[model samples]
Target: MKVSALGNEIAGPGGPGPGVRLVVVIEDEAIVLAGYQMLFESWGYVVIAAQSADEALGMLEAGSMPPGFILADFRLRDGQTGTEAIERVRQAFGPDIPGVVVTGDTTVTVDRLRLAASEGMPILHKPVNGRQLQELLTRSFKT
Candidate 1:
């Protein structure tokens, strides 16, 4: 088991002994968030999950290390988008932090495309297949 900077033990059933990668997941749905947490941990990633961007930021301990990746639902509560949430976390950490936005919304507007492009983030359509997500994460963290 690995203890986090916040003193929380990090481990999951059938998971690797200690998580080497850290991921921040911003999802509004409780079930989805739980699933992501379980899935990420099982993949040997430590997950920080929250319903909103603000909540995720609040949960982080000061001076904690930056997450290796970020996954966020495009349409969040309180009129916030995944890109915005990613930017918020990046602002706290570093702008080079990579993130992906997952959305159920089929309609993609020009503004949305522009924002994601400008931020160097990719948008994935839901429901994201586990293998696809795993591939994406593996490819992303490999860089």
Candidate 2:
């Protein structure tokens, strides 16, 4: 699906501007992806959707426009996990692109959290509140 079809508002009068903030969301669940797209778009940010780690990686490989931030689901449909996907993205795009892993699983261990934290990546519990998502995005892009 076209990224704009997910309800994103292009930044410029006719299209998104060079300064527009872009956020890549890797989610296997259609509903969840739509929800995240809507939320980020409502905040005036452009959203890119990918259904799997491989798909997301392909975009990066093809030199797709870099996103200001990335939000990914912890458990993807494929065997690949969000952490693995984010690591790949970071390796390709560098550590400057901020990322957040969203998950419904509550059993994420402290060590995992520490690893993500060490990389300057944060974890957000699933069923993310729109307000919280917006706030996090704002902070992420501002840096």
TM-scores, all models, native as reference: 0.82, 0.81
Q: What lDDT would each prediction earn against the true structure?
A: 0.79, 0.74
Q: Model 2, range 1-143, lDDT digits (tens) per residue?
A: 22333443333323335787978889988888888887777888777678876666655444345668888888887477777778777777776888888889888888987887787778888678768878888898888
The window of 10 residues in a row where model 2 has the poorest summed lDDT is 1-10
C-alpha RMSD (angstroms) for model 1: 5.2
lDDT for model 1 comes to 0.79
Query: Cα miss at 139, model 1 (Å)?
Result: 2.3
Instruction: Give the Å shift of residue 17 in candidate 1.
Output: 12
Q: Residue-wise lDDT of candidate 1 within 3-98, one digit each (tens)?
A: 332334544333333346878899988888888888988998877787888877765543256777999999898889999999999998888888
Off by over 4 Å in 2: 1-16, 60-64
Once superposed on the true structure, which residue ranges of model 1 sit more than 4 Å away at CA?
1-19
**Highest TM-score scorer:** 1
Predict model 2's lDDT versus the native. 0.74
Best-matching candidate per lDDT: 1
Evaluated at residue 14, the lDDT of candidate 2 is 39
